[model samples]
Target: MKRSFVALMAFTLLIAIIGFSAHLVVLEINDTHGHAWPYGNYGGFAAIATIVNQVRSEAQANGWDFLFLHAGDVNTGVPESDMLYARPDILALDMMGLNAMTIGNHEFDHPWSVLSRQMAWADFPFLSANIVYKGTDKTVGQPYLIENFPDLKVAILGLTTKTTEYIGNPEYVKGYDFLSPDEVAQKYVPMLQKMVGPDGIVIALTHLGIFGYSEQTVAGTPGAVETAEKLDPPNNPYGGSVSLAQSVSGIAAIFDGHSHTAVTSPFNVNGTLIVQAGSYSKYIARLDLIVENGHVATYTYKLITVSKDIKPNEAIQDLLTAYQIVGSGKLNEPIGYSKVNFANEKDSTRKADTLIGHLITDAVAWKFKDMGVQAVLMNGGGIRAPIPAGTITYKTVLTVLPFGNTVVILKIKGSDLLKAIQWGGVYHPEDTGARLNEWGLTYTVTPNGVENILLDGKPIDPDAIYTVATNDYMANGGDNYSMLKNAQQYNTGYVLADVVKEYIEHISPIESYPFTPRWTEVK
Candidate 1:
């Protein structure tokens, strides 16, 4: 009689579930970079909201649970958003009613005061488990948020990329150390297990990326070493979002960001779904899950392109339009024109010099020549975008040099400079951050070290002190350039973007600038 009763109860539950079909839907967007308007063919926050609302409306009509999530980097790109301290993005996200978000590296682009104020305005929780108060175990931001759907509860863990310590503006991220994602995952998953139990879904909403690191040895390449040591950082700590997910148990999926990838489908690893949406709000990631008995039974995914065809939310569109009118007065002012197009792709800058590299480095050296600056060095990773042929505006210059680092004049011996360059270039081509873009000196960079460094058609004097003009980022030992950490430095009090814009305006119709042949293979 007991067995019969148990079967009857099971049948009744199944019948109930079948009668009321239910689903869990997760909508994700990542690395938005403040493209809140239709950028050429890519994005507009109004359209994004429209699509999101439509999807939600349909889901609700069908009795499905819905969650709208943003991965990170919703700021620091478009002039309309960035110039106003990224408030447009915050306002738009609030209007859209974002459920949760992971704090991205760009969140630290502004000063702490500004960042704090911005965070205060956000409607949803900004999450990062690994980012802690300096020398303390407290998170710099909220660690995670929980969403309870009918019959199932999900705990979403948030982790920022560990690279923010050195890669972001140095002063902004000072005194804080980003803990390893693996350690963070190991620390939190156990507690989460107690809270959510075995049947609940645990999702990691992380900004740590799948940065295409490979462990397999490729001849004469540093990528593998970086991958191995990076995968398991110092103290044998785990690194990257994937490593964190693979190390921890019970995580059902990881909605990842920071690489600016457009993953059309989930990258499944060890039964966990790792997914990323394209950067700049180009697409919205839709993850559909079928829950059975308080557990995810199966899932499918799609990336909805924020194409021009979609209608935008009228309110958001009006707000963006107003902001654009207010911000565009000077930003849209034509600075100059360049007839020649120059590639600034990271690989191009790291492997060999491009015209854009030459233009920036030359501008730095030329702008500060009166101070006896011998050469100027900027990181290849610093060159954010290519200088397109034809019209160039103030906004264009800002996008290229967005960090707002000041020109730092430093006195350094050639030997120490070489060490700094070599240290920074330890993983050239494979690592763009280490590739030094410079003017007033031409050097052939190899995997082994820097050689053939020329100054005035002569070899660099190792003992002689030379005046170097570089952004404060490197002068402050950013990107692991330890040798540059203690150099005799002077703050020029000039923002890098202003200097670049000035140069462009001064040299109005720039017809051509060729490669000075930096980063030779030296075979």
Candidate 2:
């Protein structure tokens, strides 16, 4: 009897060991841009859903776990998604069982109150450990959340970029402070790890751009490479998750977004795996974690394009269709028609006179005319795309200028205006070799071949006063245009898109292309 009992116990132990060898597959998407339907043969909500379902089914068959995550910035690309207030896209995400997401700066491009309201609708928690709430020490979001799958304990912490000025209304983030990623890790990881113990897996879900360090510029060039490499592992006595993943104690991965760039492969910071699923829902990232003894023993990462191989989920398509039915009424209305053919050339510096640019600048000057604004200087880079002549609708406006950038009227001395012009001339190192967009105003290139000062064909004096119309972006020195930072600012609540809409209403549709070059070459 004793011999039989020993043999039975050994058999049970062997079975348990096999059962515990379960693996986890984490799939994530970022910067969907409200594309519920795939563009070309690539992704849409339906096609992505098909991929998710397949991954889940296979994982289940193998006794593995599956999870879905997003890095935010879901709305504002297409007319259907933007006009419907992002409901269709959010509904689709909920159906896909998205566990958690970080709030991107674009999320606040609407209004502060609207952002709070939208957060209420999310099925999964919206997280951000770094954004501070105004007038209090508390953070602006759920700092961290743990998603438990059977025996697996997965912790996801959310973070936004520290540079808030580039994305939204600075006042929107006013009263709220932002903590650095390192600071956040130092503060929270210790306490969380003590509670969850060593078996828990921690991931930082960030909208802080694709590059890992501060020096990782948008163009994928090394920005802070040497500095990042020399930084020591985060000193957390409790063995917390704080490293940049390379040397961070317990962190397993980092999923990043915001640069609108794609990382085709997983980036290894130290020994940690970092992945981003490009923007516009163009791709999905798949990461597999093999856990043993309550820790990640091994891992693998792959990026899957949301292409034709997978079938889109029908349910998501139906939801989008229902929303589109409503949006079609408002978005598809032909506010005005354009008779001229407008094209946005990739290599053009004179972005002036394109139908969309003209319509936008005209709107700006018109909106702020009541506030003593005489001229407008719209940045060419801000003009994302041209107005395709065939059908100009509400949706068209949103895609053309996605950032809900408000127009600000500036009261500045003539010298200040000259400085602004000079700043634009040398904004980037590549400026001299390439021509950037110029509009309305013309300047003379000095014998030095530098952009010298001029306005209305005369040399600009620094102390003379001028009324200028520009967007809040330039006012805050975005894109390295720092000269406008000191100009007296006047708030014009009128949105650039709304201004365009009014211009369209006033002009109606033209029968022939009426636009001509407004840019003047330096004589």
Candidate 3:
């Protein structure tokens, strides 16, 4: 009897030890934006695959439960990937063994047909709990995925930013509704929790962004802080990942994207962990968690730069090379040359009027000059890359403007035009993508609003009817340019990239344009 009792005790203790302790390693990347190839030693899918394989192998060797997730925005940015409709990226991500990815606004850059085709090509599920067919409960993709391990179960719920309704191409996203993230999580978290059972972890894989770390309210959008704190209605209009963490009881962590923010360390908000790996495939975020009694007891987080130092994975590298060869055949044709570089970095163009901004707006205005288009307006977000000094090619122009937006002429009242300009200039001009670039008009941004608005060197008459050239995206009210939504619009049926290329070609050996600032700011 004594021997039997001792043996029983030993068995019970071993069971407890095995059940109560476990190791989990999660690798995440967000907003990759079609960087399947390396940019001068910075980032590429091949390098990312090598890192993922290495870490996955390490995890297996260490007996840790492993997961690889993408927070979203895997499309757009690179002409090589864009030309192929991001098929190369989808294939490479599948080869890398991606467990899951959320839907990003850029996923809708192309029409639904393209997105559906990409979805069919991908092995892993594209998750989004908040996107649904209009007036229906049917979700566009899997709402959440449950992964079971030896001693732990993890439920990942995907949430996309609500801004997709206005930020995405309207025609492409017409039939889909971007439901409130918090509301969707509220409905899903409890169900997920019940499924995972006690001690299991629930995480939000989100595309919602952090607009500003210091201010909860930036450009009238609720950021992570505001969302977490549950600010008033006007302030907390759009709930983000932080909001999901705070409002939902069971979520343990959130991996987020869409503001291109690189969170160096995990943000602990309301006992939930939030992290973003930034954009452009530049970094991979790794989180190591220790699970005790089915709950996360401790963790360590870091952002690893995907630099050229790492050897590329052979298979992924070969796949990307094949796609590059195909893409290069059409994109490499030289169109013109620039005497000086035109800067269009996100930070530069989005804050102040830039040379590239001028060039693009000028191109649009020039295209419709015969139609009596007096001025041009463009959203800085539409401009993606800088035009380097030498050897401009079709690839170069396409890289700068990949959305394929068409030039639109709107007969808008001058009052409404001023409103649009003010909305762009005064509303968090520093980071908002809606910041405006102009041609044939000049304005000064003031603390109150815009002042000294001029068209053709004369003050804009409020009641005068004016023809303004802008992309179809904005004319269709993209980027929250509501003032232009009701205006009379005529689509020129010309792709903006082609128009810019033609303009550059026409003005080849492009050395200097009017350098006078089209817009200025007052302290």
Candidate 4:
């Protein structure tokens, strides 16, 4: 009887110890497009600091540990952030005390020199396991980082989206070759596991998108069943985060970004849990894990909204105040008022028409009116964010047309013009340089073919030569618009954003330029 009682007591003791062994809090924020200050009570870096500090304190009080991580895309949306070369955003994040972050595709939007400077400025390592320096095997950023706590050890491996090569400024990423995340994972995951042993947890902090942005039926698009086990990142990893979690083992969870989707729950696939916090400094994703015997015994995911109710961190708030005083004074000067919400060029531009695109193209056309340019062709890739319905600011203009592209007029054969329109329409569903949004021209594009090519409301003569206004990027054959490579280029010194600013200020109370179905994609 005593033997059985002692055995039962030992079993109960084991249960108690297992339940109280270790508590780990993983805090994540991603896709924070430079929203350092609150906009109508939503999103601010001060609030994020408040939440992080609160969570960290709470975890410590409970005899647990915490990690603060940012996924990617830290800047490039707000004028306050971008105009100063993302300095405000970078400084704010550095002060917020982030443990580490992965490199997003947008990080490559600036010059390589600028990227190098930002990497140096950061307090934490910018992680990217797959990105290798040009002509060398060295990883550009910290391929992986290890953190040791009293009770547990954590291994973090970072991977940038392969799309960074194309989606980012082509010129900026010319030297670096981004390797496959899957191949990188196969090598690193095992090495990490061997180092940490069974009790440690391995995590993939990746900037690869969770899903394709558009779900609208794209005509002439493929519908084949793809899986991570069979297909590589090159063959369509179908949202690299989900794909890798399904295929790779030993990864406890994936903290992901680039899609801006608020993933609240722990999505279990094949044994791994994948989660992503929403974007724009709006929410802090808290992933809690109870680790024992080198395995996650229990886990929970929480998306803590950065609402106004949470008191802002005083120090961080003060720093942001100084930045806002300068940036807002410059950016907030009301240029005009808009009659409509200039939507983000995500879903609408991918398949159909968007007023924001029209406004930009129209501005470009009007800017070169004296030059006798028959039409304006603005590459959809250049349109960054959308304008909300209301008072428009210079900041709004900057955010809408962030890239500092200048106007360059080109002379192209009418046949090549048709090809330009066809090129933009060809990659429907899949975003590419070919998605040309234009003004002073109209065309109907279906999966079958292009038709009704009109220039100045007249049928385009395939052989007639025409002067066309386009951005310098496209004229240089960015996004595979190869036809314009050898065109007679007429350089216009006007910056695209400045042109847009002039157009808006020139016409106050700017009415919603009626979005006629100029570029129709028949699904």
Model 3: residues >4 Å from true position, as ranges? 1-19, 213-235, 429-431
- Cα RMSD, each candidate: 4.6, 5.7, 3.6, 5.1
**How many clashing pairs does model 2 include?**
17
Report the lDDT tens digits of candidate 3 across residue range 1-523.
9999999999999977765667889999988888889998685899999999999999999999999999999889999998888899999999999999999999999988998998999999999998999999899989999999987899999999888998898878889989988888888988998988876888889998764542121221235345435431222437566666666677788998887777777767667788888778888989998977657799998889999888999999999999899979779999998888898664567678788898898888887889999899888888888999999999999999999899988999989988888888764622366888888888888877888888999988889899989998888888888899878988989999999999999999887766778888897
Of 1 and 2, which scores higher on lDDT?
A: 1
Each model's TM-score? 0.90, 0.80, 0.93, 0.86
Look at candidate 2 and tell me the lDDT of residue 381: 58
lDDT of 4 by residue, 428-450 (tens): 44344357788888788777877
Candidate order (TM-score):
3, 1, 4, 2
Candidate 3 clashes between residue pairs 3 or more apart in a chain or in different chains? 199-294
lDDT of 3 at 174: 81
Candidate 2 wrongly placed segments (more than 4 Å) = 1-22, 212-243, 338-341, 344-359, 366-374, 379-382, 422-439, 443-450, 472-493, 504-523
Top model number, lDDT = 3
Q: Give the lDDT of residue 57 in candidate 4.
A: 88
lDDT of 2 by residue, 374-487 (tens): 567766656655677766887677667666777777888776676666555432421221122333456544434446445555666677777888877667665445566778
Top candidate, metric TM-score? 3
- Per-residue lDDT, model 2, residue 327, is 71
